[model samples]
Target: MSNQWQPHAAELAEGLSLIELSDGLGHLDLGDSEDVMVMGVCDDSRHAMPGYAMLCLPRSEGKATQFAESAKEQGAIAIISVGVSVDTDLPHLHLESIAEAGLLLRRMFKTEQASTHFYGITGTDGKTSVAWMLREALARYQSAPIWSSGTLGWMRSSNNICDIGNTTPSLLTMHAMLNAACQEGVHAVVSEISSHGIAQGRIAGLNFKTAIWTNMGHDHLQDHGGYEPYLATKAGFISDCAAHGGSVVANADHADIRERAPESTNWYGHGLDRDDVNLGWEQELPGLLRLSCAGEEVVIEDIPIGDFHAENVACVALTLMVSMGIELQALPELLTGITAPPGRMQDVAAGYGQVFIDYAHTPEALERCLKAARKLVRNRLIVVFGCGGERDREKRPQMGGIAAEFADAVWITSDNPRGELPAVIASEIEAGMAQPYRVELHLQLDREQAIAEAVEVLAEGDILVIAGKGHEAYMEVCGRRMPWSDAEVAERYLHRKHPGSGFDGERLCA
Candidate 1:
């Protein structure tokens, strides 16, 4: 038989028996059932299996109850819970931590694999972009098939994509995706390595071929507990990759990355340090940067706006060169057709001022994006943005400070107010801005109205940045998601005035 299902699937098929388990006694009653094996334990609800188990306490609100109810309804046979002591009549497994469950599964499903090539990218911000570049380049170098599993989605092709519920899927799911790719003859698999993923050992069993670091900055302090711990988590990627016989592709431009550079024989550098790096870019336009790496140079081929992305592109190029052995000479020619990843720094042209949509939630990214937008604005830089609910609220003020310093005017609006009041979140942001900026601040809770106001106030040379949402199609408000698109609203406003003069159909506008 092909290595497809191998011995694990056979074992899973045969040993698929229902087991009732509980850690702490009496108070919690776990319902028992037959024919249900809770697929290892995981805290991430996105990776929870319907027929498996779920640990719900770590989440903010009713995540556990909601997930349990949903999973049971979807045919989940068992639940591994942490918080509620009273377990339902459903088959259940309770453990101190989900990690314990994961350990059990690994031991039970011991299937050995010969080879697996994982490309891991970690950074404070640009992890997704570097991963994307590496994925694209691998597809070019190896005529063999490839697939990408990240926050954006699983890209079977440039055109064919699937939703990725998590930035980093659980170990079991990661292996499953890789197994699927291998079954399909995939030669390369690029995955985004979040700090949490590295810290949690989600990518443990997988062997990596290359590790890329876009840059390091402040983020995930709440999860990591502090900045030092967060930095350590990011550092683990390079260390782990080296141990796995994979090369490190690091950005020499970043101070933190440079200081914590890992030891690797196949190390390649990328950034503004052209004196000792493999990749660098020349500023071509206000927001466009011409890329040059190895022996090739690709003119600004409609880059995803913002200056920070230039570094991201370089990191991707260098990773491709080191991992797949692709020459830089081929980049310029190949990049001629490449476009910006969905919402990294996508520019949407409006009739009056140009609108740029980006996924800049962090303070560093917000600062970089605002500065980049400022550079391109001849008249004024208008910003419409907000902070997400149930996230790192500490950065709210920092984000406001960055916008105040760069954007000529800003309209603070709601962005994924998951469970928090939009007005409350907006107020937190407003409190961070300087008093002088208050005059320029517009409080328009309706994102569409904010975009409309920005467009209406925009002149010919002005630039409008509609940020925080980026490529997402829905707006999460008060525990529910509403179908909304900043790009759509901007385009509608544009079309209402100029019919075909927007970036709606064209990749880039003149």
Candidate 2:
């Protein structure tokens, strides 16, 4: 493999020579005066490699300095910790905050900043879809490569994508990806910024040229303490982008986002048939979504998708035209062949009505997916979904209630019950259903069996939706992530039912 992604120590310590990061008088022993070269930065000692700089952060468990010995044994050359001292041969640098130091370290190690326009999309539901659509739209108007980083990973191109393990990666990893993109002559980078990313300083120190707020919902409530803090965290991205002389494109359909939008910079809003929005969409036909932006109309045909997708498309168009300078007239042609991100309403197979696999884990997202699936199904709509373990437990009941309200038949199953009992998680979800004892509500602990049963019971005109683990390839149970795929399971069952029919997976149309 190429070493182009690695950042040298001298490059990483560019502005650290005379900087005073904290108010302390250098109380602790700052290690021996040996010059060190760092090949990488690691937060976790388990992932520490030779010549890496270990960033010791304070966690709920303990101080990160507790793992310094392990990282040193793994060949860490230097240590940067907050409020802790490690006695080792490695050089130690103390800072009041490890997150701040990490952000600064990112700035130092990153290659010459790319002129590439950076757009950040943050919200509860449509971050991935809007970012993916922005990447697709940018690819059509520019010759330089467009990079996208989010749940789908660091996408160098549509065909070449790699996972970085988070919706927004660590500050160091984010800079590394951006540096690599700049080195490869990428023109723009669009990333899905999450609330956790914003609150945790994962996206700190980077300047976004434009920020898009898709829509905020009641997800991640546990992480942010409540809905107010969650919304505030999402708003921080918009504030930072505007402070950097950038603009914001907001979803006017969301009242909270519209109210909290920044007044300092130019704000462009988009929504569904709203008079105040800069871009508005009206569904002219069953499968066609017509958008009117700046008196120019673009007709999206044959994609009898959800209103959420049309809203996502409208957000993309407004962001490109208002923030990125793409002409409004070019939207229709550019958006013609664009498809949703992998598993975001991804139609993996057809034949018996259709089967859609989406990453709709939140109550709002699940409701949207089922409502969209309802429009496409001529008969009954069956949904298979489950809440993730150790996440926002409050959303479990809400998701279950949405499934109960929307789908004709609801299948509650396991979804990455990491370190938590699958049955316990399913019970929590079942608690939200108004009619938990209804005959149509099927509770299956085994996700694969649940999917198979769902497929088996689907009528000819029925639609089957497997929600909650869209593009994820692993199912985490009892802290171990085993290999699993919702789309693959659905396909296998569909093929077993219709043997030798040459049922190649194809996009279903209305």
Clashes (backbone N, CA, C under 3 Å), per candidate, total 1, 0
Candidate 2 lDDT over residue span 1-510, tens digit each? 132332222224332331233224232334555355556667777667777777665441354556888888878767767555555566776666644565555445654355767889898998888888888878887855688889887787777776677898876677766666666778889999988788877765677888888887878798888999999888878987887788888877678987888875333344344557677877644557787765667787654377778778777777877766777677777777667788888777754548889899998899998888888788899999999988999899999888988889989999998988989999999898885355388899999999999999988789999999898889987778898888888888888888888985332321
- Tell me each candidate's TM-score: 0.77, 0.88
TM-score of 2: 0.88
Best by lDDT: 2
Clashing pairs in 1: 31-89
TM-score of 1: 0.77
Q: What is the lDDT of residue 89 in candidate 2?
A: 62
List candidate 2 segments past 4 Å from native.
Answer: 1-40, 44-52, 58-63, 82-89, 98-103, 110-113, 264-273, 302-304, 350-353, 436-439, 504-510
Across 50-94, the per-residue lDDT of candidate 1 in tens digits comes to 555554433324456666666566555566564344235576655
